[model samples]
Target: MAELTTSWLGMRLESPLVVAASPLSHDAEAIGAAVAAGAGAVVLYSLFEEDLTEELAAPRPSGAGLDPYLRQIEMLRQQVAVPVVASLNGTTPGGWTKYARSLEAAGASALELNLYEVAASPEHSGAELEFRQVDVVSAVVSAVEVPVTVKISPFYSSVPAFVRRLEEVGARGVTVFNRFYQPDISLDTLQVDRRVAPSTPAELPLRLHALALLSPFAKLSLGCSGGVHSGRDAAKAILCGAHVVQLASVLLERGPGYVGVMREELSGWLDSKKMVSCEGVRGKLGFGFTADAHAWERLNYTRTLHAGLPPGGGRPAGG
Candidate 1:
């Protein structure tokens, strides 16, 4: 078997496959199963800023406060031999950042700061929003001893530049994208409805594009999230310079045991290609590796347009 070991956020992972932050981490047993099935690391479901703020305003029920979250971190450290990463989801820096220290003290190997905010206000400039996010990350990084990795959204105008700022503020790594759940308009009830849908293979390209762009210049370790469904997909991500392949949807659908299956597929693909290790294929397809990545992208765009149009040009088969 080709060596699957990968170094991510300064930690040596037995494999590049990491279980992403999701409800799967809510169950200690489920997390144990994932680690047993070959997960290199596990990111616990987010401890939202709103939850912390609300608890401060008015204490929630007994089991629904910061104490339980901290306890969960401690418990997971004892149960899983792999790195246990704690997730904190918020946009602004405030007292909530203090919890990052607590999380580190609770034995979290690292922290994933999920900066999930919609830039909905025209009043706020992109620069201003980006600055605020950087501040938040700086605060948390300064507060914790554990390595901090930011989970960013794909909506940023200049992803590479924004990531540069994060790196300056002591971020050890970055996950390419965070999935923002969209709201649906309800015709019958005349209200906005919330829906959650799992990501598919189609979503992988966006992550790959970002990974290719960032992997070359970024000093921080890169993680690919969203749309990784199979071993082939995982191979594509690593080829684009991702240090780790973070998965949640497929595991949720197929159960944690699927982790072993994906690992086998990745190993099989590497063996077939005669690659000896994950590092052997990393960044071979990234922007920096190409002669002219911008020109290549433009050429692909033109080719796609030319091949997509039918003779009449009404619509293509899939269109």
Candidate 2:
């Protein structure tokens, strides 16, 4: 009943509930289910650029490539009235542009570049790696007429600078921090293993950090998406300056119908707050709004060592 409709990356979304790039959105059936469940738009499973290269031939099952995904994407656009976004994660700039066009032809309303790379090479400096990231985003933006968004990892040293670079390269928006797998040890076999799952709710500080950095830049629309659980969580993201909030973990827990429940909860909260739209509350609680905002400075951690009730409260690390 409230004015929940909004524009994201220049596309009109009836609501702000976007189904994040996940297995659930890989097929027409799931996409339709998401629409029925009240998703504003569906971001197709991230198609890997490596899936198109020789690297894919190296034994392991490759990320399902675009070939098998076209039919699903087409059907989703036809069967659902909401925008259907195409997501791509590629290594080369060439494939990014080519695939962006192919996805557009397949009926995607917009594009999300999950621009990923792990620069483990000692030969390349961090500076070079950052430049390559900018080049990749620029190439994709130049190749696509559809509104473009990029999903970023939290591993960068200068997140704000990285986001500003994406904006300069013509990205319409940025999603704060994609949850990549971290490798841990398998004690039994003494092997490395990656835990593949959504982030826990405790992992919210990173999003808040991103929100603080990107919210002030009017040209950048931020999507704070790391550990959102409920309507209050969603509301908090928007309040801290995210333009949209993407969900993966909560939906995985409660199923697609959770979308409607969260939407309803968000609407009710807005009504209670005497707000008609998300835009009105957006960024109202950001650092700029607080008087003693400087406490957010990371250096405060080292300086604020108060003696506490706990035994080792004021002691040094590992004391």
Candidate 3:
């Protein structure tokens, strides 16, 4: 049988499939099932800075605010032998990051900084936004003893350069491409209807593209998130050099048992390819691994525009 083990953020993972931060992790029963089904780790639903700030500002009873999150981390560590990663979602760096120390003390194996924000201000240059995020990572990494990984969006002007900054700031790993939830307008009510849609298989390519570009040269462990749903998807991610594959939507739709299925599928793929282990095939198709680097970059765009030419090799009738 092909070995399914992989290392991520300096932790040994029995499987590359990780339970992404979502409501699924809110319930201990769900997380237990996932680990039983071969999930390598679980990232608890994020504790937002706004919520932390509000709870800290107002008077509340002990064990009422961030206490539950800390307890959850402690509870999972006791229940499962796998790593329990705590997630902190915020846009800015502040005293709120002090909670990271509490989380670490609570026995969190690692910390994933979910850097979520919409850079809608024209006054703020891309450089400014990027620097702010780097600062946040630095603050958290400095505060925690455990490894810190960054979950970032793909909107940066240069993803690799931004990741380099993160590496310089001491982030242990980087998860590619956080999904930005957009609100829809309700035509009848003439108001914004906030709805978070589940990720589809279509979203996988965007992650693959980004991973292929970064996997070869980045010293930080790369994690692929946002669109993985099958064994093939997981394999594709690993092939592009992802040290781990994070999935939330598929688990939500199919339940935690799906982790075992995806793991089996990855193992079967490795066997068919005559590969001995998951790590053996890692980055086999990444930009650096490929013979033509430009093909994975600009050439891909040109081919996509000319995917299916006319019979006479000219533009279609409409054009």
lDDT of each: 0.91, 0.79, 0.89
TM-scores for the candidates: 0.93, 0.87, 0.92
Give the per-residue lDDT of model 1 (tens digit) for 1-319: 8999999999999999999999898789988988998999999889887787888999988565678989999999999899999998864566548778778889999999988878889999999989989999999988888899999999988999999999999999999888988788999999988878889888999999999988889999999999999988999999999999999999999999899999999999999999999989998888995677679889888999888865878554576
Off by over 4 Å in 3: 57-64, 290-296, 309-319
Residues 1-319, candidate 3, lDDT per residue (tens digit)? 9998999999999999999999888789999999999999999988877776778689556443578899999999999989999998864566436878888999999999888878888999989888888888898898888999999999988898899899999999999978998789999999999988899888998999889888878898999998899999999999999999998999999998899899899999999999999999999888895666665677778887878765777644665
Better of 2 and 3 by TM-score: 3
Give model 1's TM-score versus the native structure.
Answer: 0.93
Clash number by candidate, in order: 0, 0, 0
Model 2 alpha-carbon miss at residue 222, Å: 1.5
| lDDT, model 3, position 118 | 83
lDDT per residue as tens, model 2, 74-123? 87888999988888887777888888889988878888888677877899
Clashing pairs in 3: none
Question: What's the residue-level lDDT of 158 in candidate 1?
Answer: 90
Question: Candidate 1, 236: how far from true, in Å?
Answer: 0.7
- How far residue 130's Cα lies from its native spot in candidate 1, in Å, is 0.2
